[model samples]
Target chain A: GAGVSQSPSNKVTEKGKDVELRCDPISGHTALYWYRQSLGQGLEFLIYFQGNSAPDKSGLPSDRFSAERTGGSVSTLTIQRTQQEDSAVYLCASRNYNEQFFGPGTRLTVL
Target chain B: AQSVTQLDSQVPVFEEAPVELRCNYSSSVSVYLFWYVQYPNQGLQLLLKYLSGSTLVESINGFEAEFNKSQTSFHLRKPSVHISDTAEYFCAVSDNEKLTFGTGTRLTIIP
Candidate 1:
């Protein structure tokens, strides 16, 4: 892909249900990141993965939030037993520790 | 820890008007500053960055930001803004890794 790509442009799930969002980063990008953006709010960092290094998981809000980037290409963000507060745009970005390219994003709604 | 602060939550200006978006940061070590723009339904894309030297950095779309170390500010400016420039702008700072962002400023360019 010429840019980062994400699946299911929108995900509407009921509260207490689990949701999985996927991201396919740009080819050759070694760093991947996930962020959450609520309505009219700034991005909240979620996680960052670099090569084979231990992912920087310090930004994950809770144990329910987990992410995995398999083979350094595609990444998935999972929110378990989702709460209404989890409703937001889940954005995926990939970079080389310099300029980042981002996906169109997945809009998650917990009703 | 590095933190960023965007003073304005929203700014409304007439088309072709000059605009300035203010950002401040707090960091204990040398850091990198960046500005990102997000259009509706899209993920964030880098606007510019100030990593080292020159204090001033620019984006391809006529946006420029100046890094002021003493004041801990990286204010973005454009001599003229078009309606297309209306979007949410984010300021981010990173010491060695992991960018911390501020509440974004929504720039609405009115025609």
Candidate 2:
């Protein structure tokens, strides 16, 4: 079975530009989450989607960070007006029951 | 609010020596504890988790974790380590759907 997958393993963009990271969850997994891994901060939860319920956005650091899971499968994390502080590895994971399986993250570097 | 703390930012152990990665968590309610491992340029992999029924949980790769409710800790341990064990270990606690992670501990294996 295919595990969770993320696209654009690495991305480098201008500070003010917008970047979109994509994730494809495992089949039959209803829970998907996005997290940011930075050098100083380690790992920080960003957003989560559980089935058809409302996505948990409490972890989003700012208004410029948002994510949406469409058709209950694929998810995209969008960062608007990215800052140098936003440079980090964007990891995605999906869970069916308890343990979550993660994808190889997309490293975003805002230059 | 739920939070996790990994006291050691890094743990360097000799090959074939025992290693312990401490993880302490704080939550208002009961929580689920998990340990995850990440190699360089890779995603996280579930190492072990303590859910219910028992206080200890083991992973297939000779790693185990004990959930101590009174101490608010779920520390991971291994009797002996190998050179391949060099990676980052993260401890997380989940009270709801989203997990609160600690600043990971990087384990370096000394030859």
DockQ per model, Cα:
0.67, 0.83
> Candidate 2, residues B1-111: lDDT per residue as tens digits?
999999999999999999999999999888889999998767898888888989989999899999998898899999999999999999999865888899999999999
Scored by lDDT, the top model is: 2
Per-residue lDDT of A1-111 in model 1, one digit per residue for the tens?
488999889999999999999999989988888888887655888888886354589878899999888887889899999999899888888886566677889999999
Q: Provide the overall lDDT of each model, using Cα atoms, as 2-decimal numbers.
A: 0.88, 0.91
Model 1 - which docking category? medium
Model 2: residue A91 alpha-carbon error in angstroms:
0.9
Looking at model 2, the pairs that clash are: none
Off by over 4 Å in 2: none
DockQ (model 1, Cα): 0.67
Index of the highest-DockQ prediction: 2
- Computed on C-alpha atoms, the DockQ of candidate 2 is 0.83
True contacts kept of each: 0.68, 0.89
